[model samples]
Target: MTLRNQVLIWIAFFIVLMLALWIFRGILLPFVVGATLAYLLNPLVNQLQKWRFSRGWATAVVLLSVVAIILGLFFMLVPLAGQQVGGLIQRLPGYASDLQELARRWAPELNAWLGPEQAARLEATISDLLGRIVGFAGGITGEILASGWGVITTIGIVVFTPVVAFYILLDWEGMVRGVNNLLPVQYKDEIRGILAEIDSSMAGVIRGQGSVILILAVFYATALSLAGLNFGLAIGLIGGLFSFVPYVGFAIGFLLSMGVAIVQFWPNWWMVAVIFAIYMVGQFLEGNILYPKLVGSSININPVWLMFALLAFSLLFGFVGLLLAVPLAAIGGVLVRYGVRKYKASALYLGENGDKGGDQTAV
Candidate 1:
């Protein structure tokens, strides 16, 4: 095909692909989860294959290993986590009371500024919010489970994700080669370069950042549990997971843990201080040591831009968009850089009549 025809065909194909994705967006969740699962497990499968195992067997081994680890966690931590969740829900009224009392401590100052009537209304509003927040999570979950179909869909997605992952992992190489072979000859190299960039960015987030998250989770969880904090494991895990978002996770975890501490251990300032110090040290280690050694410059994304992408995508496509935000942002960053480079070297940039070569050579 001619170069112009090839370019046009590629554009048409892209349009079709995007339209198809939109049409089937609602049903894409399980497949998306399965594809992500395969992507995560494929590395382990490849490693075992290199040691002389067949692809099928290697996939089986990896899947089995993953299941074993999950089962172990279930047995070891799930009960405690569940108990903690129940306890927190049950204690919501008490938390509300504590928060209200704490707010009232400052009501006198507010009364001086805004007068007693407004200050009293402000306290009432704060109390109402606290009470509502206690049921906010349960309300959402109840809504999701309100219909029988919702429960069935949830169960189906959980049950079938592994099955889809196993098949994809076994045939991963064939799938890659098939897609590569179908790429237009003119754009294949360019497309391959972009794919490689996406792979590099995903590796930092999925593997390197994943390791950092796990380390932080264990450190914080264990430390908090030792400190006798209520729901320490859950709080620590939440903090570590949030670490995936740079500074936001640590801050959330610290504030949450401290809030619980205030409710559970009020007038005991030492424990709250300890919790604060733990998160501060964790942030310091991540900034100075872990990130540079592991993730380094692999993902060329701005943290603020990433948060915006997450918010926008999640709003547009719900959970799928949220799950995809980071990857899409990374890919978007690559395309932007590509566009800027092309623009800088184009005739329009140097001026239509300017000497394209002489201007470049002078620099």
Candidate 2:
């Protein structure tokens, strides 16, 4: 085939593959997740096998250990989260009252600025806004609890994930070899090089980001708990997990925690200041220590590009898109780098030094 024909064929193949991935994405998530788990656990399984353990035994042990860790975290976090949520729910009414009173005290100053009639209208508008906010919050909570089929579906996914992961881990090497064998022989070396680069990039990003997030969670949770803030653990967990998306975690945790501290300990600026200080310290530590250590040499996606990728993917494919955005971005970066390298070597960009003639004629 001509070079142009080969290029066209390859483009068509990729287009079809992307379309298939988009159409069957829902069914693919579990498999994608399982494959990632297998990849991450492969090293540990190899080490176990090196210790003279049978492959089957090593796979079982590694899978079970992973499952046990997940189960333990669930058991530990659920009750704490439940208690915190329950307490927050119970205090909702009092928080509303306090907020209303605070607003009312500020209304007279509004009256002096806008006159009594306009001020009363402004106050009513504010009250209505507050009511709608509370109603929206209540609606979300109710939907989560009352949507029976949704709850069941979620539970099923949770239960089956580990089972899928276990089998994938057990057969990971065979799977890799099978895939490699299927690649076209002429392109096998290039494909292998790209795959290795992708693997290294993904491992660095996923494992490093995960470790950093865990450390930040512990730091934030401990600091908030020591400061005696209600819902501290929840805030910290949310912050740390979302920290993978740049400043999102810190912004969310800081704002939410500050708002809660203000309402719960009103007129006590000291508590509010302390809460802010704790979040600042957490941010400092993450920037100076955790991120540097964990995410070293990983894809350096700028904040603007990162946010754009998140927004675009989330809009296109919802949660799965959001989860895959960073990896996709990393892959795009790799492709771009390769393209740049090729361009630099190409005749169009090389001027008089172009590979147009034989080596001896290239002055």
Candidate 3:
């Protein structure tokens, strides 16, 4: 077969593979999570093997340790999270009253510019907004309770994921070698190079970004707690975790924290000021220290492109799209860089003298 025909066939195969992944995403989630966990832990398992331990033993040790840590965390966090969630629910009515009072006190002055009817209309609008917010909160609470089955299924998946990861880690090297051996000899070196590049890029981005998110979470939680905010721990934890998607953590944390502060201390500008100050300090630390130290220069996706990709993916595939967006963007960035380099080197783009825009070369 001609090189052109081979290229077409390879492209067609990849398109089909991507379609399959998209269609079977629900079934694939556990395997994908397991594979990612294996990738992250493989280095540690390899190090244990170097200490004269057999590969199987090392894999078993790592998997068991990981499982123990996860279970310990679940035990410690679940009760605390449940308590905080319940407390928030209990406080909702008080919060609603505080919000209503603040609005009633402030609305008349702003309404003075307009007639009483306009003011009443403005108050109605505000009431409608508050009602929607309450409805959303109630909806979320109902969903959580309704999702008892989902919670059980999720726990099962989490338990099974690490177990699957252990076997995958153990066989990772052999799997790579087997796939390489199956490739045509003529293209083996090129394929190996591509795979190695992709693997390195994925590993660096995943590990680095994950560490950054954890660090930011700690920073946010500590700062908020120190500022003596209600539900600080919960807000900080959620904010920090969601920070993986660029500024999402900051946006969510800011709005939630500000709302809580306003509700807790009605008409007290000072409390809102304190919350804002805490968030500002946390943001400064994240921008100056945490992200720099953790992610470094690993992911080169620009903010604009990252947001666009995230929105597009989320629209197309919901939560799964959101989860996969950054990794896909990182991979696309790498491929785009390679394409640019190749384009610059090509005779079609570069002149015979290798000077861009000089005399064009005939193909």
Off by over 4 Å in 1: 1-19, 89-93, 103-150, 353-363
Off by over 4 Å in 3: 1-7, 83-97, 107-152, 183-193, 267-271, 315-318, 351-355, 359-363
Q: Is candidate 1 or candidate 3 better by lDDT?
A: 1
Show the colliding residue pairs in model 1.
none
lDDT-sorted candidate list, best first = 1, 3, 2
Error of 2 at 154 (Å): 2.9
What is the C-alpha lDDT profile of model 2 across 1-363, one tens digit per residue? 665796698789868866776786555556666666776788899999999988889989998898789789889887897687567655656666667788688788988999999988987875675566456546645754553326555665576667787888777778999999998899799889878877767876677777888888888877887888888877677678778888878876776577678787778989999999998888888888877777776676677887888888756655556667787777766766766776677766565557545454554
Ranking by TM-score: 1, 3, 2
User: Tens digit of lDDT per residue, candidate 3, span 1-363?
Assistant: 774697699689868866876786555556767877897788889899899989899999988898899789789976786677678667756766677777788776867877788888887886676666567657656754553427665875787788779889889889978998899898788767766666666765688788778777777777777877888777788789878777878886776688788877666789789899888988888789877876767677788888888888666654556667787888778777766876778776776567865754432
Candidate 1 per-residue lDDT, tens place, 1-363, comes to: 764685597689768865676676666677878888788888889999999999999999999889789779989988987687667657766777887787777788999998999999988886766666667646633543442237666676767778888889989999999999997697799889988988888887677777888888888889989989988888788789768775778875776677778777877888888888888888888888888878888878899999998778666666666667777787778778877886777677776766667677768
> Which parts of model 2 have CA positions greater than 4 angstroms off?
1-10, 82-149, 184-187, 351-363
TM-score of 2: 0.79
Instruction: Quote the lDDT for 83 in model 2.
Output: 82
Candidate 1 overall lDDT versus native: 0.78
Question: What TM-score goes with each of the models?
Answer: 0.81, 0.79, 0.80
Evaluated against the true structure, the overall lDDT of model 2 is: 0.75
Best by TM-score: 1
Error of 1 at 181 (Å): 0.6
lDDT of each prediction vs. the true structure? 0.78, 0.75, 0.76
Q: How close is candidate 1 to the true structure, as a TM-score?
A: 0.81
Between candidates 2 and 3, which one is better according to TM-score? 3
